[model samples]
Target: MKTEIRFTHQSLVENSKSGDRTAQYQLYELYVDAMYNVSMRFLGVKEDAEDIVQESFVDAFRNLDKFKYESSFGAWLKRIVINKSINHLKVKRLPLAAMDDNEYHLTNEDEHEYQNIDAMDIMKVKSGIEKLPYGYKQIINLYLLEGFDHNEISDVLGITTSTSKSQYHRAKKKLVEIINTL
Candidate 1:
């Protein structure tokens, strides 16, 4: 017989913790489609994205009790999806550049350069990012766009923290070069 599903946040958590099969399925169904979109943002391949989404849901479910509602369920699920995508890429052994302790700084005057930049200018910069090589693109996306710190990036990409820092520098340089060409 078909069962009814209640979607309240509290109900889902309580039922999920109690091993209610129907509620578990309901939880998965509620988030899978949205999580798949999140997965696809990192993993462009259709099947790979789907696989990441499924793995994320499984992982999320396994740790559901640990979810303290510090963030919404959707946010929690999105993290899992993103983590899965990073792990999937890591398995392919993408040649990650190592970072050094040297801090590369841009000139202060140029630092405020985007002050007058409008939406189109930002879009132009984003378009340039798309042209970067895979390694550069991912580094920029994670370190700059996603605001991940070097240590976090190093762990995610399975590279040294110094490597993460160096790759970020290279990615920024390449991005600026691309934007200048446009």
Candidate 2:
């Protein structure tokens, strides 16, 4: 028998907006683990990720009326989780290169060169992505992991579309360097 996929949070979110505390708590419980994983991907540190997760959920609950249900509840919560993660990182103030108009190029040709690599190789690439500098890692995670296009990333990161593209190029370049070193 196929196990049932529960949608407790999605249901609770609808009810929570109507001011149901129990439903709100259920929603919190249902999404907490997944949100924590999202935060972990960005923050990398356990305590910080947990803190962000808590804050995101609290914010989501408090602002429940703002949820229009355009996206899935998970997607909405994930956005909140990501925003909290970004804020957490901002508090750390990691050094980043200033935005420059000059672009760094990463071609489809380069990506294709690694397409035939094994799973271990793919994991290595992800590891390299994790090791990238703060700005590069954030851009890469938003673009690659979160599936945001350059236009959307520009809005989210408060940069130009060209800047988003440039950052991604630099991030990819740094990834390639890391992969080559391994």
Candidate 3:
């Protein structure tokens, strides 16, 4: 038998489910910034991220009855924000996967410049990710930062699992190169 996992804020969820406006507002306040950050990571624009996060919260609240506590409310809300962000990108004709074999071409003038740098810190990594192209950045953000596996990424991006795996590997290689040059 399976059981629903209890959430830390179970009362808030339950109250919100029962049409309690105050509980809903509290839940929104708790998650808004985090969800906005998640959308920003994908969409990379302040206004778009804000809109996506707001829409995600509205959808989550309206469909509160479908949330069975199998996952934390934060986790469920995060998925909503991510999905909305990706859809926003798709509607705007943004790239989710690198085209062809673009990640394979290196622009270094000499082989001596390939020295590996190991002084990676959070700020450096964050800046490096920001410098990545849209496709590579999405893969890195999803697979590395967001902790999504290839299968989940494939499902989210509507691609095959092999494509997701390959894209993630290529994106990681590009990210490492960028970090080294930073």
What lDDT score goes with residue 129 in model 3?
85
The C-alpha RMSD of each candidate to the native structure, in angstroms, is: 3.6, 3.8, 7.0
Residue 54, model 2: Cα distance from true site in angstroms: 0.4
Model 1: lDDT to the true structure = 0.75
Give lDDT tens digits, candidate 3, residues 21-112.
87888898889989988999998899999999989999999999999999999999999998898889889998765455343444444323
Model 2 C-alpha lDDT versus the unseen true structure? 0.80
Instruction: Pick out the ten consecutive residues of candidate 3 with the lowest summed lDDT.
Output: 109-118
In Å, residue 137's CA in model 1 sits off its true spot by 2.8
Candidate 3 segments exceeding 4 Å error = 1-8, 98-119
Q: What ordering of candidates by lDDT runs from best to worst?
A: 3, 2, 1
- Predicted structure with the largest lDDT when compared to the true one: 3
Regions of candidate 1 where Cα sits further than 4 Å from its true position: 1-4, 113-118, 121-127, 143-155, 158-166, 179-182
- Which tens-of-lDDT digit does each residue in 68-95 have in candidate 2? 8799888989998987788778778863
Greater lDDT among 1 and 2 belongs to 2
The segments of candidate 2 whose C-alpha lies over 4 angstroms from its true place after superposition are 1-10, 106-120
